[model samples]
Target: MGARIERQKNILDYTLAALLRRKRKNAVLVLVYTLIVFLLASVVFFSRSLQREAADLLQGAPEMIVQRQVAGRHELIPLAYLEKIKKIRGVQAARGRLWGYYYDPVVGANYTLLVPESREVAPGTMAVGEGLARLRLSAVGDDIEFRTHDGSLKELKIARIFPAELGLVSSDLVLVAEEDFRGLFGMPRELVTDLAVQVRNPKELPTIAYKIAEALPDTRQILREEILRTYDAVFNWRGGILIAILSGSVLAFILLAWDKASGMSMEERREIGVLKAIGWETADVIQMKCWEGLAISLTAFLPGVLLAYAHVALTSAGLFEPVLKGWAVLYPHFSIKPYLDVSQVAALFFLAVVPYTVATIIPSWRAAIVDPDAVMR
Candidate 1:
């Protein structure tokens, strides 16, 4: 009992002495470790946030949407089919919508465009996407003009705004009163684009979309998976690239920290060797290093994670709508109810601190085992 108590005291004493003596150097290692962990955490957090948001976005969309798939190309379906779709059981409200694209001079791209089903009133009152609005500093009632890919200017009054919080799927979204839609396009009311349906029960969604597809032979439906896959095609790919790039920087920092922690100076070697000679053991050495790893991780991770969250918030506030391609509106900003569950934090600790401390232990144990005479020599 006495020996164990003595050893524990020795470990605490040596560890404190080491920390105090190497404050500046140790501080740098801790900071670096913290930063690496922080970046990793942010990556994990953001990826999770993206997946969750994407899933939510898909979940909220019309239980099902149908478009025409012709020879592997999606073509617009006629509005006449909406009545047929409505007659189907489990369908609450079925509305005809037009999906297309528009070019925003401000954002400099052809964004996925949305028009109205009603040809009469849709011209003057347009609903701009929240994302496109931010890009142009536009708001409700602002006059927005865009040329279609075919070189026609369909300038219209902004009626309402759509939020793309989940997908912000596209940056340019313009909805107008349908009466104006006919006049703008110089086309008759016979043409329609897409069908959006709200189902009585979600379980009935796939069956309904499938039924619509069967009835309308030419129409293709946008299922929940399709929308999510689209999001993945865009954001997921981009997010992965970002993660890959950021991972390199994080890796570099981790290595730098590991090297620094492992490479104690001659003075530290001497001090540790003396402590060991005076009866310190491996347990004492490990506890001290574990504490060191804990301290460093906390210092780095807290600030790093906070900074990443801030970055996402600021970026989304400024650019969510402009960058997304579909022209769908998304919520401007949403706070991720971060899964700060114990498991997540614990995983981070296990991967970062535990490995770091384990790595630190190897050198610490070596130093502890050194014969004082040999080390002195």
Candidate 2:
């Protein structure tokens, strides 16, 4: 056993020396390999992290949202609908929600206006999200003006700024008094943008949603799980777009790798011939090539993964954030919590590392079995 181990170590050492002999070539190969891994890993890490973030944020979301549909479009829901929904057997509570969007031509972005269900904002004052505050260059105690539906500007003082940690959900959010929201949008006092419903038992959500739909034929029931799924699907679709865009480069890399693996360079062929002539068996030659491939793969993969982790967790994936996040304006500035899935890493390994290793070994095996004189000439 010890003899076998010693022989393997010697082969690995020889592999290292051989790699070092072609420093420039190996360096370039490692760089390209690392870059491919980095790009692929970055996309996976960023998208999955965002998905997790969305899920975590939605955990506290209402079990169901009820919206009124008018001619197949969302319309204001009457407060009267709240009573009907609250009467549903499985419903723990139901309440009308006041919210809408305001377009700020000055900032070239839209702001979400909402009435806080749990707290009251004193009349004539509001709470703004960090992103909105940053865009408007305003802070607490500053007044922000919104163009009311009547072609008039209603100004409100920023009483508070939401904490940056909640930026994912609140980035473009503006919390205002219900009365102010109605006045800004010229909405009737007895109507709301939607209804938020809570349930006693979580499993009965779908049943309750169906009941709500049945009772209010003009209403649409959106469950929390469906919202989560929508977010997941959106991220996945965006990730797919990025992958499609990168496919050309990826294909090129694969072709390069295949060519490199299937056809050994003349120098490499000669080196294998010399080793065979010097009494190294076919298995030993194959083993050395296997070690070389593994060395290069590991050297590339580990750093690539580390770099990707840093890019997402530390830098918030600056390179791919714009495309993946889908927010062109009022882009929320938030850090992605580091998330690693073993399966994802393993998938990346099979895609990036395993093929190259196999390719390296096959060509080396073919060359190893040939007559040394023929190979040398």
Candidate 3:
């Protein structure tokens, strides 16, 4: 046991020293590997975050929504429908909500807008998402002037800005008080873009929605699930883009790993053959090379992951949307804290590090088994 332990230690020490000797060259490879791993982790992390956010937003969304079903037009529900919904058996609360898309004329970008300027909103107040707030060069207490598609001019006072996402959609959310919303959009009391319903028992929501639909035949009472289909498409788009960007890095990593292990120098090959000639077993050679791979992966892994965390912390959520990052106070701010699970870390370590280590063993074994005289000749 002592002899075996000594040999393993020797292998580790030599493997580390060998990598250190080529620090400049190996550093470059490690740095690239680190970046690729970071990107991969970030993509996985970001995708997980997106899924959580989408689920939270969709689930927190009204259990049932009543809308006007028209073939090719936006449905405007009556504001008074909230009262009728309250009388339903399982309904806990009901409210009206307004949502629309706004074009940021100053920045030439569009926003998925939510206008909740009702009694629920504080007076003389409006809220905007961090996205629109920065893009428009507006902040808390900044006066925002927006002209609607229908030639309506709204001079909204920015009351407070909140992160629209708490594991939810962080899109362009704007909130204004009901009285101000009327002035801003020229909307009537009977008209609303959507009706939000809350239920006492969430499990009973489907039955309640059906009952509400039957009760209110004139207006359509749709579950939040149906309404979320449009938003689901948006999340898919964001995830796909992130994946495409990171896929390239993974491809590069496979090539780098292959080249590093395959192309051994003449001296290195001779050294390996000599080790074998002097009684180093094939397993020892493989183990030594595996140690090298493990060291590279481990050393790079933590730094790369922390680098990604730092980036997200510095940029905030702006990293997700590269377009508006310019106006971000911190380039990448991590409002959504990453939730680390043992399984994910294990999977990442296996995929990023273990495979490369195994790749290293293949070439090492080939060199170790070669005839020393033949290699020297």
Candidate 4:
């Protein structure tokens, strides 16, 4: 066992020296190999992070949300609708929710205003998300001014700011008092943006949603799973598009790899000839070439993935952020918590490292089988 280990050590040392001798050629290969790994890792990490953030928030989300549609557009539902929904057999609770979008022309972004059903904010004060606070340069005790949809300007003092951790969802959120929300959005007291329903048993969620739709013919009932699935689909679709765009680069790299494998330079052929002429067996020659491929593949793969992780988790996914996150009038500004899934990294490995390593095999074997004396001539 020790002798086998020592043999591998000697082979690795020889591989390193051989690769260094052709540093210029191997460097370009490593750079391209690293870039491919980086792109794939970035997409997977960004999409999964968004999905995770959605999942984290979903745990506290209402089991079902009911909204009224008039002429195919969302309209405020009457608060009285909640009374009837609460009477449903499986519904444990039903409450009217207040929320709406406020477009900020100053920043070319939109802000979401909502009133918490269980908590009350003072009439003149509100809570802002970290993103909104940063954009407006407003902090706690500072006032933010907004022009109401009806052409009136209103000011609300910032009572608090949401923690940075919630930025993914709350980056543009503004929590206001119910009365202030109603006033600023021009929503009447009798109406709310939607209805939130909690079911007594999770298994009965579908039944409760069906019953709500039946009771309110013009209403749309959205289950929690539907919302989660929608978010997953959107992120996945966007990620797929970005990956599709990147496929061109990947194709070019594969062509380069194939060219390298099939078109061994005269010098490389001579080097293989020399090795075989010096009492090296065909198996030994193949092992040396395999070591060289592994050295390059693994050296590139590790750092490529690490940099990709930092790009998404720390810097918030630089260039790919817009693509994976999607374009929004008001985008969230939260950094995703770093998460590593072994399966994802393994998939990237098989996609990148395995193919390149395998590509080297055919050429190595071809070179190894040739007559050393004939090749030298």
Candidate No. with top TM-score: 2
What tens digits encode model 4's per-residue C-alpha lDDT throughout 220-325? 9989899899989988998899999999998998999878866777888788888888877788778887887778889889989998999888888887876776
Candidate 2 collision pairs: none
Query: All candidates: CA RMSD in angstroms?
Result: 5.1, 1.9, 4.8, 2.5
What TM-score would candidate 3 get against the native?
A: 0.75
* Sort by lDDT, top down from the best: 2, 4, 3, 1
Among the numbered candidates, top lDDT falls to 2
Off by over 4 Å in 2: 371-377
Tens-place lDDT digits, model 3, residues 1-377 = 99989988988998888789988988988889888877766655655555555566677666777776677455777877777778888888887787766666677766655665344557566776776676677779898877844687767788877664521244466776666666556677788888877888878987987888787766676777765665556555666677676677678778977888667778888888888877777788889888988898888888877776665545443455562122432222326555555676678888888888888888878888777566456
| lDDT of residue 301 for candidate 2 | 92
Stretches off by above 4 angstroms in model 1 are 1-14, 83-93, 104-123, 127-155, 158-171, 229-234, 263-269, 314-346, 369-377
Model 2, position 20: C-alpha lDDT score: 99
**How far out, in Å, is residue 191 in model 1?**
2.9
Candidate 1 TM-score, true structure as reference: 0.74
Clashes of each: 32, 0, 11, 0
